[model samples]
Target: MPPLFKHPNFVHFWIGQIASSFAFQMLSVGIGWQMYDLTNSPMALGLVGLCQFLPQLLLTLVVGHVADRYNRRLICVCTRFTMAMTVGILAYGNITDSISANMIYLCAALLGTARAFEMPANQAILPNLIPNELLSRAVSAIASAREISVIAGPALGGLIYLIGPTTLYLSSMSCFLVSCVIMFFLHYNFTVKTKSPISMEHLFGGLRFIRGNKVILGSVSLDMFAVLLGGATALLPIVAKDILHTEAWGLGLLRCSPAVGALLMSIYLARRPLTHSVGKIMFAAVAVFGVATILFGLSENLILSMIALVLLGSSDMISVVIRSTLVQLETPDDMRGRVSAANSVFIGSSNQLGEFESGVTAAWFGVVPAIIVGGVGTIAVVGLWMYLFPNLLKRDTLEQ
Candidate 1:
């Protein structure tokens, strides 16, 4: 057995992550497709991203502090349960033919709130599951799990969407419930001993830590800006409907294309991890991601678009594995939660907020132009970041 699978806690964590991630991906497809169907406006889709991201933006500090102070496992379990219920609401509403665009916005907000807590806690707990030597591979393994969901969830959701939105919502809700139960049984030693009463310093500790650590800050920010600019996934529905002239199933395949590339890259990295020039490799991967995004934006053929997405995911997996391992290995365990929380903000900003950006830009400049511009912006950020964070560019390995 692989070292990661041998650890029972890690296995449970892995399975739980898969379930939750799968549910979320399906929820995304369901909500996004439904939102677009109801309003037929690109701006409404943008609002979906905005509503989901606002909670995370507001709760970053409190979330970090809570993760650091409270029991992380409990936090994770409760968050999953909350998400299950949130989706359950959607399922009920859809089944009764009472759902609306506003309801989706509200659910997006609730789902975002749950994820704001869940993401950082999950990131913090991984180090506790295995020795430091295996951290890189573990990160890759987790990414592979997520990629599998990304590949499967959307395709399945797209197929299931043909049945009914209610069915998709119920399926997603059940997945979230399963994840909650699995995480409830997950065991971990919470040795964090922060007794300092609520103070500004404690709340902002994660941000401060990242600011002080140039490599960590640079790596996280690089991803934030690059993806923030190059987030083409947000416009997949528009692309599939108008450009590719396809339906829900085609959208599902379009959504999963990147994951297919990401899954393959992640599996390879897990088996044979990066050994040297890790910093250079990550930058190169981001550059490739930018180029792929441009290709995707320009492609009208479904096959060509899928190929571009595959490249995007493959390159992105390299960057994710490198950045995740770097941040976790560099931070002290006691501070992991807080630091991971701050890191999650960067991730949330890049993904959720980036979707909003893409939507707004697509509305303003047209979908293809917005995507192409974002891709160009991503490449520009990479060049600028290399100049700004020379330490990250020069860093030799993931090991502290």
Candidate 2:
């Protein structure tokens, strides 16, 4: 048997992640589609991102502290339950025709609250479930599974949305419920030692630790800046409706194309794997992502747009694998939750803030110009980061 799938715990975790990811993807697609249908404005989609990420940014430090001081499994279970309840409420609203933009914003805020705690716990627990030798492969497998969910979920949601938005919401709720059950059965021997009292001092400690780690800081900064600048997902509705002249199904394909490319690349990575030159790979892949985004913005043809999205997805996946492996390998076990929380801040900021940037830019300078400029800015940021962080650029292997 392959070392990557050797542990039952890892297998269970993988299954649970797959289920949750699929449901999450459905919720994402449904929300965007419904919001656009209601408001017909790019800013409304951006607002959705804002509502979801603001809580994560504000609460990440506290959540990280709690994760480190408590049983991670307990944290995961509680967060999942919270998320399920939020989805259930959204589902009820949708089914009864009471769904409104305001209701979605409220639900999104609740979901964000759950995510602030859930992300760190999820990132930290994976290492505890497997041996170090298998860690990189495990991360790759999980990324691949997520990519698969991205590929399948949006397409499915798009088709299901044609039937009704409630269908997708209900499906997402079920996935979360099932995930909670699966999480309950997982067995692990994890225990937090010497629970520290919550204080400003402990929170400061996490910030100081992250500040001192140059490689970790640089890698995360690179990812954050690039995504913040080049991400065009929030304006995908504009591209789908105005540029590509398509409907909900087309919107779903546009969203799913990147994941399709990402899943394919992830599969290749899992098979051969890249044990070195990861930094260089990440840099080049992000550059490719920028170029793809530019092409996507420029193209009016649906086929061309899909191609661009696919390349963007492929490049983004490469960066994700490299950064995640680096973070997991370098972080100390005790500090994993805190560091992962910091990671969530960077990631959440990039995604949510990027949406805001895209929406405002699109509203001001036209959608195509906004997307093109964002891509150009992304490429420039990568070049600048490479020049500034020479050591980071040369980091070819995961820290031992």
Name the 10 consecutive residues with the lowest summed lDDT in model 1.
188-197
Assess every candidate by TM-score.
Answer: 0.88, 0.88
Q: Which candidate comes out best when scored by lDDT?
A: 1
Clashes per candidate (backbone, < 3 Å): 0, 0
Q: Model 2, residue 181: displacement in angstroms?
A: 1.9
lDDT string, candidate 2, 320-396, tens digits = 87788778888887888889998888887788778879989998999999999999998998899899878778988
| Candidate 2 Cα outliers beyond 4 Å, as residue runs | 29-48, 91-105, 158-170, 240-250, 298-300, 363-366
**Global lDDT scores for all candidate models:** 0.89, 0.85
Candidate 1 whole-model C-alpha lDDT, 0 to 1 = 0.89
**RMSD of each predicted structure:** 3.0, 2.9
Question: Per-residue error at 346 for model 1, in Å?
Answer: 1.7
